[model samples]
Target: MGDYLKKACCLLFALTTLAAASPVFAADVLHIQPKQHDCGLVDEGVPATMTAVVENVSGRDVHVSSVKTN
Candidate 1:
C-alpha cells in the first residue's frame, strides 16, 4: 500500500541517516604533515580533531567518507 511504502521509505532514510551520523569506528590519530618552512617562518602542527563518516552498507560496517584533518 501507499502508506506502507511511505513508512518503509521513512524507515530507510532514518536508518541511513543514523548510520551516517554514528561513529562506529575511530582512528588512533588524525594528523596532517606540515609543510616545510624556512628559518623565519613557523610551521603548524597536526590537527587535534577531525570529522569522519561511517556507513553500514551491505550489512558491513565501513568507513565511506574521506579522512579529514583539522
Candidate 2:
C-alpha cells in the first residue's frame, strides 16, 4: 500500500511538471499566394499548371495525404 501510494504521487508530480514546462503549439495554416486563378483561353481538355509554394510555419512539418482543386 505504501509503495503504491508513493508511485502514484510520483506519477502525479511528473505529469504536473511536464504540463507546466511544456510549450503549447498552435494549429498550422495554409497560405496561398495567388488566391485566384485565371484560365485565359485555355482549352477545356488541355492540362493547366501553376506554381505553388507550400510551407508550414507552425514549428512542425505537416503531412499532406492528398490535394484536390475544383
Candidate 3:
C-alpha cells in the first residue's frame, strides 16, 4: 500500500509538470508589441498618447470583449 501511494504521488507530480510545460498552456493567444512605452514628460492638463499593435496568433477569430488602459 505504501509503494502504491508513492507511485500515485509520483504520477500525479509528473502529470502536473507536463501540463504546466505544455505550449497550449503557455502560448499567448494575442501578441502585443511594445508592451510598455515611456513618455519622457508631460505637463498638467496635457494628454499623451501611445500606440501598440495587437495581433491574434492563435489562428482563430478572437472577439475582443473590451480593452482597458492604465
Candidate 4:
C-alpha cells in the first residue's frame, strides 16, 4: 500500500512536470497579440506587421533577438 502511494505520487509529479514544460505552459506565461489566424489571401510586394506581447514574470530583463513569419 505504501509503495503504491509512492508510485502514484511520482507519476503525478512526472505528469505535472511534463505539462509545465509544454507549449500550453508557455502560452500561459506569455500573451501574444494579433493571435495567429489563417491568412486568407496574399499578393506580392505587400507589407504587414505583427507584434508579440511577452510578460517578464521573472522580474529580470529579457532580450528578444528576432522575429520571423512564414
Runs of candidate 1 with Cα error greater than 4 angstroms are 24-70
| Candidate 2 local Cα displacement, residue 10, angstroms | 44
Cα lDDT tens digits for candidate 4, 1-70: 9999999999999998898789775565544445344544556788654445455565545465776668
What is the per-residue lDDT of model 3 for residues 1-70, given as tens digits with 9 covering 90 to 100? 9999999999999999898888575466555445545665678898875655555556766777876788
Backbone collision tally, model 3: 0
Residue 65's lDDT within candidate 2 is: 77
Mark the 10 consecutive residues where model 2 has the least summed lDDT: 23-32
Across 1-70, the per-residue lDDT of candidate 1 in tens digits comes to: 9999999999999999888766543432232343443334344884344333333334434443654434
Best by lDDT: 3
- Lowest lDDT sum, 10 consecutive residues, model 4, at 30-39
Q: Candidate 3 vs candidate 4: which has greater lDDT?
A: 3
Q: Candidate 3: TM-score?
A: 0.37
User: Could you tell me which 10 consecutive residues in candidate 1 have the lowest summed lDDT?
Assistant: 25-34
| Candidates' C-alpha lDDT | 0.54, 0.64, 0.71, 0.66
Clash pairs detected, candidate 1: none
Per-residue lDDT of model 2, residues 1-70, tens digit only: 9999999999999999888766342122443344455555667798876545555545545676776888
TM-score-better candidate, 3 vs 4: 3
- Give candidate 2's error at residue 7 in angstroms: 45
Instruction: Estimate the TM-score of every prediction.
Output: 0.34, 0.34, 0.37, 0.36
Model 2 deviation from the true structure expressed as Cα RMSD, one decimal place: 10.6
Error (Å) of candidate 2 at residue 44 is 4.7
